[model samples]
Target: MDTYLMNERPSYTAYRERFLAAVQRHQGRVSHYEHPLKGRDGETLYTDVAEIGNPDATKWLIIISGTHGVEGYYGSMCQTLYLQGLDLHSLDADTGLLFIHLINPWGTSWLRRVNEDNVDLNRNFIDFTRPLQHNDEYDNIASVFNREAIEPEQRRINEQLWHDRAAEIGETSLRSQITAGQHQDPEGIFYAGQFATWSNQTLRTIFANLPKSCKQAICMDLHTGAGDFGHPMLMAITDHDYPGLEAAKKLFGPWLYTVHTAMGNTSDTGVSASVDGYTSQMLINAMHDKDFMQLVIECGTYSPSMLEHSLRFEHLHYLEGNDPGGHQEPGHSLKSALLEHFFPHDQQWREIAWVRTRQIFDQALVYLRDGQTHY
Candidate 1:
């Protein structure tokens, strides 16, 4: 383990232990969804659900972490912190708090952004009965991501391809197409699997089990990356406007960002707006009969140029059959850089991320309990 990580970041095993302990200490009702795979430490992997307060409550606040795997570090830390600081008895009898910890356990455990099957879990929630969204341009740059090695020749070819594509379609468009999510190539970056992932299915099952009497809920899916470094952006992302979106606006006022995602849409929020099958939209669809709000808290970290290089290098590292679990050679250096980008070693960044998340949670609690209709 890196010295900084030892002092700052906790491994997946350590995180899970702390979260489970915190949940128990808070007297939370817990359930575990076990993943078939094991963690890098050979420990069992699970998506644990812990509910504090009345599970049968009419109003609930759901906080989900680990949608992007490695990004779950920030989410998991915040969730654990919230539980430790929570006064369980202060919560209203009609209100409940549900914590979905590490939904993408495989990704978190392996220190990769994608799941065990290399699928981006965010893009795996689409309705499979319909045709999958295609990114035709992904094929043009597919070779860049499909490289088996990170040699000088591979880097040169990759750079030339990116340069050429940027010249043709402009750098911004090229970036959007690359990350907009695609299903054409299983090996490509941002590959949306042909079928729903285990994490996707697990999330569906979790929502399906929601108390029938629950009429209103606010769900915050925690994530990191994009936006300005150390700053957390609260957003409501959906394909169409809904009552929950209006409610979010009323509650947060100028603090909230509304992103309507669709084909040909562009967003300045730094998240990909052209993609479909987001976890946010999935929650909206699953709770169509109830008044529900799907929110995302994305904390900014590093520069786009650095992020791009890190992602590419890590992808190549994975493709070359490097064991991310090992702390040897280039794999250690690669994983360390990737981890730092998503979850920075900077103390201030960690503090700001948690503080912002706590603020949002606090506001949601007040709204749920006091029935505040506006900020």
Candidate 2:
């Protein structure tokens, strides 16, 4: 396990240093929101906000990472690389850039997909006052997902149950139910929190404190570990078609795919269409007065068919094993294949992801540079 992760993401301190240094090169200032907990190596953690250009800029481009925690390994690299490559002098007066690094610092530090409370940060952005959203299909599959122990026999049972359900409802529908998220069982995988989490509150505060005059925004929440390996898919993901969908379509032309999420919905993008409380939706709802394009750059890692079982094993290890206390020691030992599921070690994979992501950023910056964007 130790050897496999030797080439994994940089340490949190290293990541922070690299990002901060890159921002300094541009003479940018970072508003650091320090996390309450320390990292696996007993390192300080923070979600640093690097805002570039005019604070009162009407056009804003914001890039965020670490929504799923462990996936931040990849997301952080992208953020650092992008910042280092950005030419701050090119920005117009009305458009600026914001990089929100490591939204769920605790999750990244401990190498877990969920936050410190086992909540999927992406799924924790919903309103707690309203009745929680339900997935009847998730309720039916509770026996499989909510298992306390994942023994060989238990693994077999879970597999057979998955096959049965896949045959009954079709594989795509089954996948939708599994990833749509639920709040009923805290121990279960993809569990949304029962209330607002610290990270959730922090992000909301970041938005609320932003310059109120800003009208148009492009908020991208980056992710990995889905779809074809090494492919970075550009998607506009939301619970419904928001106002900026057309703007996104026009901006990216054939490079973009629009995903309208709903219960029992279908998509080839490998993003969950049935999931609610996505960061994108929350940003849109919170700043409804402005034209906001809530986007996602989902760089594909390993296939979900292989990753689901691997992640479940890790989940059980996290649930049953001793906590790593925000230290570098992960709850579950890392395997090469599992590591690739989030951070592929292949140089080609890294290059492709960077090249594609940079291309998209180039387009986005141009849109911000010019008042209008065209293919």
Candidate 3:
């Protein structure tokens, strides 16, 4: 087994243990922010932040894992792998690395894609001072997600609604509309939540406490379950172009896909473009005074259709008062499928995800250490 893959575990508790051990092995400065919840195994949960090199470094490379909790395994492995191979003495004096592990620890522990409140942390980062972003179109398809049964008739009705909607608006647009994030329905999938979730607040607090000398940083939010199988897509997703966007463009050149999200916008990159309050944008807003480029490494595993099916079934399983990690029949089956969708059991896919993610981190590190920023 590779040293980095040590962090890849069957359960969140094991993964977190491996992560903390790796951090200690590397002598990285660690801070534990406890989550007010327990894991599926009744283990305590936390979002652990580790900093390597000078804490006051002006240039930083921040890599975040587990923004979408079920996807944390991939991110955790990437992080642990990087740490295992990282040489603290060889790092640039002015550059530091920060790893935020399992921001939504509850979801990771429970094998869920959302946080404790069923809030999609990615979509929960919006400004609560103003009115929440409304997805009127999501209401039209809410019934598909609201169903609590996986019976043949129930599944058929839901699938037929999706099919009909796709026929009416095209599959691409249908996907965009369905995933754009909605605030109206707490029970719906991709629920943005009425306010900042614990993960959201915790992330903000982490950003708020960055060393004052930190002026420029390249942040990567690790994710999975979109795009072509075994492919890791590098993306700069934001509502508008920021100072760091051009620098990223030059650094990554054609390798980076720039996504400017807005209402009714679409992208071939397999990410929702119509959504607001993305974590990437939140990072931009948080570090407005600094030159920051927020990037996402979304690894592909299974098709969107497959993902939707898994998500809906698992959601129903959850609604039916069954734990995803439960040993029972339907719950166990649903959990397995959902887990496979986000974090595939396929070995080749896992290898590709880690290799590609490592490459992305390497490039960002080199740029942070030596490359110039537009700011």
Tens digit per residue, CA lDDT, model 3, 295-353: 99999888857226788878877876745565688788878788888888877888889
Off by over 4 Å in 3: 1-9, 148-152, 304-308, 372-375
lDDT of 1 at 298: 97
**Can you write out model 2's per-residue Cα lDDT over 6-64, one digit (the tens) per residue?**
34555667777877887888777689998887877788889999988787888888889
Can you write out model 1's per-residue Cα lDDT over 42-115, one digit (the tens) per residue? 89999999988887899999999999999999898998888888888888899998999999999998888999
RMSD of 1: 2.5
Please give the lDDT score at residue 176 for candidate 1.
80
lDDT of candidate 2?
0.78
lDDT of 3: 0.84
CA shift of 373, model 2, Å: 2.9
Question: Candidate 3 — which pairs collide?
Answer: none
- Model 1 residue 324 CA deviation (Å) reads 3.9
| Residue 52 alpha-carbon offset, candidate 2, angstroms | 1.5
In every candidate, how many clashes are there?
0, 4, 0
lDDT of predicted model 1:
0.86
On TM-score, the stronger of 1 and 3 is 1
